[model samples]
Target chain A: MATAVAKKKKVRINGCVAAAQAAKYADVDVITAYPIRPYTATMMALAQMVANGELDAEYIVADSEHSQLSIAHGASSSGARVFTGSSGVGVQFAYELYSPISGTRMPVQMMIADRTLDPPGDFGSEHTDALSARDMGWLMGWSCDAQEAFDNHLLGFRIGEDRRVLLPQMVCQDGFFVSHITTDVELPDTGQVQEFLPPYTHPYPLDPRRPVSHGPQIMPEQGPPLQLERARAMEGAVPVIEQAHDEFARIFGRRYDPWLEEFMTDGADVVFFVQGAHAVTARYAIRHMRERGAKVGLVRLKTIRPYPTDRVKDALSKFKVVGVIETNLGLGSVSSGGVLYAEACAALYESPTRPLVVSFMAGMGGEAIVLKEFYWMTNKMLDAQKRGAIEKRTHWVGFEE
Target chain B: MPAIEIQRQMLPMFPSPNQGARFYNPELPETEPFVPGHRTCAGCGPSIQYRMTSKASGDNTILVGPTGCMYVANSSYLCTPYNVPWAHTQIGSSGSFTAGVAAAYEAMIRKGKWKGAFPNIICEAGDGSASDIGLASISGALYRNHDCLIICYDNEQYANTGIQASSRTPYGGMTTFSPPGPTIPEAKKLFPKDLARMMAAGHPHCYVATASVGYPIDLMNKVRKGLNHKGASYLMVYTPCQKGFVYETPRSIDLGRLVVECGLYPIWEWNPEKREFDYSFRPQNMRPVSEYLKLQGRFGHLHAEHIATLQKFANEQWRMMKVELPAALIRAADAKNLVDMASAEAAAAIAETV
Candidate 1:
């Protein structure tokens, strides 16, 4: 079979540009932007795309993040595909819109280039920003690289806009590691994107032709059913997400495990559970450790929100030891560490064969989890496995011996 | 990749009530975008303004109700009064959400997706939203020139939250947050913001006007004119609250008229085309501030000096509009020439009893 290299157009670009390209290919009708850190690059790319006649969309530079999300919500409610993005505290600034956009069932897609929350104003990667809104009824996930970020944007729109799951999505990536770092992403043809993602259409939009009232005040008794319906839609999205990914793989020729991505886990006793861009470095560290006859592997989580509870339990049950790498801050959370540890432990607690799970607080304040830190985290997990019991629930990486 | 002939709806302007020798009620659009059977208080001023604005916009419209009296009272318990396509937005998202709807329609029509005339996009924002929290959002929408209308129903204070002082609350207005005290007899010390003029000055390209629910035909015509405008338009309406103002329920329309006649709430249009103020729209007759203030109990706490200050403020507003103040109105600005409200004695007796 001929490789057909001539047909495939590959471009070296950052995650921000990849997201903009995905939006352009998706042919979004409206884009609302408010500049913050690394996420601002995506808006800049989108602005240029609109300026150069490359995309026919209404690009509004909003006054603030709150307005940006509101504009996206309004456009989505009016039956237009909306694309918007923010970072760090900017994501928190628009926190008010998260619940309403989802509860109203507007499939507004927001690209998040994750940055650490402020105090010192660090522009590095941290999952806390997007993770903080985990309970807001949004379909959330993290992409490891520019290519995955591009793929996730298109996939996010398709899944979120699905009739069964008319909810907003947070397509997130690490701030500098993926958002600023350049990588070769194979851009798909317009025809492929068209076949993969249908034009966004809400069941009932704010159209005079139809004349439907949305978000009306309801009686106290009506509140439960509405919330239950939203819950049903969220829980019902699992099947839709799988179907979309299957179609995406068939049309785009690139497959991704919709829930979790397992790498070199064969015959390994200890594994690192990670998310986002840090998985790229974790893979390298695991490969190097495998050469030294160290039985360490990587199990990277792709989706966090309609959290794959069954999948997480099944995957971790196979290993004797699991080291949860949390790149977020949950100050008073369980394990006295990040929130991911609690999710991992809770997911595994129901499993018959529970792995001795330990939380590692690495990548705090947007600092990268270097290969050395990964090795250190692995040693702690190995020690726990060797003793047949864990010393502590969490260990602060790069802080402890 | 083709030429799309976009069609837009142009609502017919209602005739002025004061057009000729006799005042006549102009025939209105039959479509009741804001219907009955809601929780708005009896003779609610904001509700009247909402009814008038939505009636003017007709059925081919989308209303963005921010967190305010219109959204809370009108859409209580999963029931809504809006017969047109309406969506409730955040208090601060008034303009941005409206802009989004406008942008969506523009793109949808241009892309040949929606097959109809462009619908009227209107945002019914409370004074709290227009003057404070949502001010920047409204300004952004106007500056971006989105084809929409943002109407700030100024009921003086935050009437929805049981009467708190907003930036648009009058100087002598007494609210829950600005109660009359030993040190602060005037209650609210600050003057009301010139919201409509601010909209006009900030976004000079937008159609900015001040209307009162008192003049139904004029208010309706202004709504039509705003929809007819190519881009963003702002209308700050004088909507008196029965609960907050402590006025009689049936006197809502009367208070609206009296406020304008007293020269406190100026009625004018900022014409973008000529880049000048259109002061042609005038109240029927001039009245002293006491006549307007005495109708509402919110101003019952005002002393003679406070009344004088308010009158002076109104005089300055009249001067700003280049209107000549009558000699009697000028004399009323002095504290010596005025007396306290008749209820002031009763209020003092009650305070002494407490």
Candidate 2:
């Protein structure tokens, strides 16, 4: 579909810059911005890009995060490719627009550079800000590194803008970890990106030529069907995500597992389960543990929404123990620790051989999960596997004895 | 790359309704963007304003309705009276959504994605949204100079939420939240916000004006003029609420005129080019505040002193407009000249019990 194949190049940039580059390569038409730390870097890069005439897009500095998302919704409703984002409490401030945007089925993309929510205003990475919006019918996932963050943004637009999957996407990365850490990212040629992601076109935009009313008040009886249709759209995206990842692999010469990226699980008895930037640390920890003749491996989850329940069950059934690293706070959750443990245990409940699952609160407060902490979590998982049962369901990685 | 040509639409301005002494309006646009058969009251003031505004903007328009009576009553049971494209936004997302639509057209037209003249983007916000919750968002849209019109159909209270007080609720007005009490005898103690002037003062680049549903031709012309303005514009039109104001349904338009005549609602425009107020628009006659207050039951509890307070407030508004006040209008601001409302005693007795 694309004719002008430019040369591909690699650049050393942070995750925020990678997101800006992805938006540029995708040829986004409208971008709404409101400054909040770490996500503000993305908007800064975009502002310069627009000024340099590298990207011809309508860049609006919205009054607030609420206005930012509202602008994105409006632009997307008018059949424009929109990109907007926030961090920390900025994400929570625009909480009201999440359901409305998704309910309208506008495939607007938001890049969330994850940051801690308030109570003293910490600017570290935390999943609670984005996890709070998981039930709002948006496609959500996390990227572990700058390169994956770049690839995920492109894949998010391609999949979310698909006709069958017209839901918004929150492509999340850690605040200072991936968002600030510079890494070598292989930027794609414009022709390759154009071929993968087509020009955005909604079936019914707010066009005067083709008049249509959107989001009118519906009767109580007519409510469920619309909600059911939204549900169907989200569920239908599972296959489209797989197909897009396949196409991405074929065209970009980069292959990635769509659901889980298992490393060193060939002959392992226990595994560390993680998402986002902490997985990069876990992989190094796994290599160190293997050299000491430990049977620990790593399983990094790529997508969390439309969560891969069957794949998680099948993969974890091979392990004796699965340690879920939660960089988020679930204050009064089921395991009395983090929220991921409950989801992981629920998915493995139907598995024939369920692994003894435990949650590890590591890499919290935007602190990196050092190799020492990862090794401590592996030892705790090994203790659970050897005893054939767990002591407590959760461990504060740095705080526990 | 060479500069791309962007095609813009310039709508023809309507002729003035006053043709010598005839007082007959000219032919209006035939495109009925807002049709009948929706569930508004018998003589809904906002519904009347919606009809006139859409009629002026015509077919090439996109209407954004934030959460209000216009959004709820006009689009009920999955049916809408709007024949043109309409989208419902959150109550606080009034300006931001309209800005998004305007920006989308700016980019889409320049990029050759959409092939047509830019559509008129209008946000119909209520007084509650315009003066209170969504104020900053509207200010942001205007400050950014988006090519759109933000109209605050001022009904004075939160009419859709069963009559509560908003920042635009006039002094001495009584809604469910602002009921007359022994301690608070005047019902609502605070004066209504000067919303339109505030818009003009804050964003001097925007064309800001005030109109009423009473003057249909003037209101329609202002709507067109706002649309014709090259940048963002604001209009705060007074639309009397029959349900909230507790008035007879047929007097909706008459109440609009009486409010302006009594000096309770000022009509003027903020000329951005001259950076001054244009007060040439005048009502047919000057009257006391009672002529407007006596018609609505919300002001039925006003005593003689309270009436003087309201008259003094109206007189101050007249002074700000630089209108020459009549002796009779000035004399009416004294407590000795006015009498208590008919039900003032009984209302006070009831108020003391509650």
TM-score of B-chain for each predicted structure, in order: 0.95, 0.95
lDDT of 1 by residue, A54-93 (tens): 7888899999999999999999999999999999999999
Q: Give the TM-score of candidate 2.
A: 0.97
* Candidate 2 chain A: worst-modelled 10 consecutive residues by lDDT: A1-10
lDDT of 2: 0.90
**Fnat across every predicted model, in order:** 0.82, 0.78
Candidate 1 chain A lowest-lDDT run of ten = A1-10
- Pairs clashing in candidate 2? none
| RMSD of model 1 against the true structure | 3.0
Taking the tens digit of each residue's C-alpha lDDT, what string does model 2 give over A1-401? 11222479988999999999898888888999999999999999999988877888999999999999999999999999999999999999999999999999999999999998886468899988998898899999999889999999999999999999999999999999999999999999887887899999999999999999989997899999999999999899999999999999999989888899999998999998888999888888899999999999988888999899999999999999999998888999998888888879999999989999989988778888899898888999999999999878889888878
Clashes of each: 5, 0
| Interface RMSD per candidate (angstroms) | 5.3, 2.9
Candidate 1 stretches with Cα past 4 Å from truth are A1-7, B17-26, B342-345, B348-354
> Residue by residue across B107-224, what tens digits does model 1's lDDT show?
8888777888889999999999999999999999999999999999999888888889999999988888887777888879999888898899989999999988888888888999
Collision count of model 2: 0
